[model samples]
Target: MARRPRLEPRETRAEATQAFLGRAADLAAEFAAGTPPRRIRSFSEAAPDDLRPALAILSEIPDLGLVVHGPRGCGVRAPGPAPLAVTDLDQRDTVLGSGEVLAETLRALDAACPVAAIAVLGSPVVAINSDDIRATVAALGPELGKPVVWVRTEGVRSAVPATGGDAAAEALLQLVETQNGPREPGLLNLLTSTRSPELAALAGQIEGLGWRVNILPAGARVAEIALAGRAEASLVLAPDLLGLFAEGLETRFGVTRLDVALPLGAQATVAVLRRVAALGRATGGGGPPAPPRPLSEPLAGRRLALALPTAWGLAAAELIGDLGGTVAVLSVPHLDRSHAAALGSLAERWPDLQIHVGEGQGFELAGLLRRTAPDLLLGAGDAVVVALRQGLPAAVLDPARLIGAAAPEVLTEAVDIALARWALVRGAVQNARPGYTPGWLKRSPDWHIKQEVR
Candidate 1:
């Protein structure tokens, strides 16, 4: 609500912008762990796609321009409000290197628009070509008088799409200059993906506790990020997405990160409030009293199969199970070292629940759903389309939406709505054809995986 003065964007280390290249193999390892053990196939469709997650994190800067450093079509097909440019790499450039083309694109974008910074994004082609993107940015950034940041996005290299968010986090933090004066008190930094009512509600809850929330890398301005170093602590809603960014802030600035489970259900929300209060007490403020539990029992007698990312899947599954819904299966985009504790936590509760870890491979999810036959299916993005065509009631849920004190009631109402429409959905199920063939799904969801390994 308050306006901050625009500051000059500072140039960063060329190596820092290129750091993602070194982490590519490590990023791919996130998928190595699963009940069945994940393996690369001939080809698999990224559930949410690779760029969406990075864009979700970087697109927070509505005023920034993105210079995609690959083929012309390599840029975002449906870019958010931010302006975009491309090197338009051709066969000639791929073989000979496109340094000049990248330089030219960067200059043109700087002269055309007034942007806080220009993000130089490397696509899979760029990675394959071994283009010197860091050197190009380092050479051209100062001349253009803009902070040129590199977001490392090699679609072929990253096994999990959420790793793109990690790239965006690393790149954006380069712009966060360290604070010099005393740290700001009663100021809490929150990393969240909630929009509108959910976001407004979360802010109001924090404000009621005499603390202010700075929701970052999601609709935050460059200037707002620049000032993050001054906050007392950082709170992450999507811990898996923002964990690296939080650590970067702590290392750059002295801001402590509130290491806690994301606030999904009523209990987690209360836990977050308590932690905020404990931090606020350092600034001479008290926390709100714990509220009554929103859900006393589970969802009547319904069973749910959820497909989501690791951290979100774990939290949402727990919440649903706690609320009385049988968590028959938990599907994740991928699992990595960070998920070790959460995996144990999940196993402790639902040891027998099958964990399907894969990219947003629709066929696999369809197969898992058929095998499990849960009462309801919940997941992120268009994967819900698969569930509906199977004549099962479904809902699209982001774990963030399940936050706040009223989360349980909201989830229950959502399940009720899906059940009410079940008959109508079943009636129309035959009308909509699934992308995959019925015979193929019946054959095996993981037939390709088996073939590749064999």
Candidate 2:
């Protein structure tokens, strides 16, 4: 037999991501076979001491059971009082085969609790034969009549706590769909993992449209999610997590799927809303149109800069142009080629705009602002620093604030609200007299106010 191909070294997170994606592709090919593909639990070499972050994320889903497989006295904490069941894979099991241990664990779980899914947390020893452990679970799942979700975190070393969170989202999407009954006209379900402050607000906005927004594993339980199968359509906001699920929902539930661009600014937002409106009309869920509003207030006279992820920056710039804003600069690290090309096209379309690309360095924004003197900054985290230094009002629009299997419409609405708030704040700041106290400062009663008597 020919020698197996040698694997290349991984030196960066991007490289690791590519490797992971490759593995996912291979798994997808395997899944195409009649048998179910093995589940992935975590991406770490050794299970971390605290699984709270992961467990807390999983707890959002009702009737979800976590099965922790480790040697006795392994010191893995059980998830807080939520129907969680744990099984110890002892030393003897590791030396021999994991088949018996896993079988016993499954039997115990089947008798004691309701098991919807099973995730494996790799210890140093367990990581050795993760494939065998996975196989053991798969063999037992059919016997127990439950789906097995395995996360293979064999050789990873990153400290990113959300790896398990992503795995959980993936598992849920695999199970939930929109096909329990006949489709409801004008109703849409927002597929998301968890609710952030921004996402919560977006859900409210969609609800205002008389659309029943179903947030998966966040505001709604598993039963409610099953009921969401009847929604007229589904919107996928977090592409990475919701993409696979959206495809499944369309196939199983007969729900129309809209894979619109994520809304980050005025133009993308309007486009998304229009698409949603069209979907509603098609589904006989049409309602009276809200009064037409200007795409954006006059932005042409003002200078603005954006610091965000690639797609978000592009969308923001497009919307800023719609509002007549002169985009002085835009920046984001890890700028993919497509985003770069899009930015180049936008620059060619609007020659007056200036754009910069860089990672979030302390001096980067200050230096750019000194040269460009932008009137406003739209960013997630680092832009706040620019705003403080330059006395320019800034908006926070972090994508992390929109976690989980978010519906596209809900994502669009969240961005719309954030942009609106940012624009209003910037406008108020621009209209204020120089040295006028900021509203945020006034709102803080604990702050010392020095009064000058005339």
Candidate 3:
């Protein structure tokens, strides 16, 4: 058996949280340094405030649509005025049951709209009654003969913004399964979840391989996902949401699953594609076609740093090592002492590798990076800043943008692209005159940033 590392001393929850936030601030400062790029206007912030912007974006996507439950102060904003359907749940309804109202809402939507799927964006008050709401929707789904997905968005406590995306993906998964015939003989479900636009690019890669890709939450409807069992296999690109849907596919359809690490560099990508091809062969499905040209080379002999969540760090480390890159430092937050010790032991196994545990945010992490400057950094969200400031290539693997409702393979492709871009940037920088700076590196104005709900 592999020996586990000793656990680090436990910090109080409050202390750990503070450390996490502090590190986030440092990271944010590093990456978000230019004029803010345009962002999709959120429904929560729109109308009665101008809902038109949100509506306009939604209108462009013909098949996909949004539904808001509860009255106006619910923070449920529809980007536009395509067709408004609101449910008013009172105190009595909250204490007793909102199922009747929800059922009525579903019936109305089924009758009036040609929606591919219905996403229930709940308010704080409505979130309190989520179970009742979901039961109502589930009951109404079969009755109305329409696929309804219930997303619980009550209380603004969590930092992640992809719950809506998760709900959307789950609904679409169900829809696809219901509508499609048993999974195509050798077909595989590509479990992609992420709010990032990179999903669009990744989908193209899988499709290029002549494989049928079922992008959870974004592209396909609920009926299509219900038919996922028919697919011969499932690939989990993101570790965070892997267990949930993978287990479901296994239980319902007897589909085999391959839990590969998210592909980043050239070696990792080839390894993943090869493994996927193997799974296809095992299931009697045709393997991916041979590449027209050779893929990029591995990052052997390079010094790499990783600043990411604990789950992603472990998986990434395995891939990084396989590529022949030397992992000089890893900055992870919230790891218990035993896990940290185990990680440390694993690092020791690698020649010249170093591992550090702490919140992703903090002066300590910055200090460590200053000491052991790495050639690359792989992390989610704000941690990309450290790499940027230190002049190293960095990839941001935001979980919100990587998992839940989007296509998992797309997320994998996005990571591959980010890695490719970083490699390109590094090559260009090396060729440039010493002390040359890129245009994006120029400083910009500092906009007042709002606090995200924790």
Candidate 4:
């Protein structure tokens, strides 16, 4: 029997009401009152786009060497488990120009790794110095017989962290030779993070339908990236992570993207597989997997708060609702317009779901948690600590685990476990002193957040 799609609600918004979702920039923009303000309770509702996105993609390509160019404190480490070179600039270099150091750094890395390609990541200092990296890379790339690309990762330039990933994708795309006449039938490109057993399982499922899958930045060779222009279509594992990359591919290579929600719960996963199988019909080998039955709605009547990355938090809300949970509030490290439609859909479904956007706002979260008093707290590391300390049932969910056929159940099981320990969690909360944060600060999550539009 065919199962109906879930959470496919009509897009509707209240005619008169408007709500604000906070962002990290709001907190950072606040002018400190004193030389060192009484104490800042800084945090955002969403995860900040850090250098991890840039590093994750660069380190995934096989034999790709990295060279970080910036001040010593910039900490320009490449993403992933791969090794690379770093050119730490001092105060003198910032004023005098680090051109000589950059040239020497590239040469040393090339000599050490002899890689097919080299990626240079820029720090705030490079941006400040107005470094002409393009001219340098153009001059050296031909002589080295390898593609040399630069990713502008200067923290001062962009308020959003994912911009680093965009810069990385733009650089890496230069390495792809889009001259492969036409896309091969049944070829699909997947844009996500590195290799994992869960991804392998997904690949196996797609392969079972007679389609070949190529995952980017995870076991993908330089040549494979070059051939990406020839893929029939592309799918994004996490829209927040790869939306821009996919957009670039579509713009440059004419690869159609399956713009859908992240495949988390059963219904969402089924939707993804069905779409893949439908695309596979051209190659004569796709049959949708058995439709997932309606979720039993285990979290019904439960109020929960979610502290997660923007995209994941929104999707998880829908998933939680499907399982009968109410996401009363969500805290994202940041917010962007890429998934405005999806966010809108979620908002339509849960109009009263309060959203707080900021970065590392512990005091704010503590206050909000106290006020909301949700049944469970679902988020990543710090959120877990906050909840556990407050005696709330808490579940720590790494964004990576929210994939594959079992993702929904994994989250539910964690929620169940946390709930089972309710008494213990409460005991810990009861014994703790409430003076960790002051009464004034705990009054509002945005106590120090500036009220301005960036």
The candidate that wins on TM-score is 1
| Cα lDDT for residue 380, candidate 1 | 71
In model 4, which regions exceed 4 Å deviation?
A: 1-52, 76-79, 178-182, 420-436, 451-454
Off by over 4 Å in 1: 1-38, 42-50, 77-79, 178-182, 448-454
- How close to the true structure is residue 401 of candidate 2, measured as C-alpha lDDT? 51
Rank by TM-score (best first) = 1, 4, 2, 3
Give the lowest summed-lDDT range of ten residues in model 3: 38-47
| Overall lDDT per candidate, in order of appearance | 0.69, 0.51, 0.49, 0.68
Task: State the RMSD for candidate 1.
Answer: 7.5
Best lDDT among the predictions, by candidate number? 1
lDDT (Cα) of model 1: 0.69
| Model 2 poorest ten-residue lDDT run | 13-22
Give TM-scores for every candidate, taking all chains together and pairing residue i with residue i. 0.85, 0.53, 0.53, 0.83
CA RMSD per model (angstroms): 7.5, 14.0, 12.7, 9.1
Residue 173 shift from truth in candidate 4, angstroms: 1.3
Local accuracy of candidate 2 as per-residue lDDT tens digits, 160-189:
333444444445554553226666666787
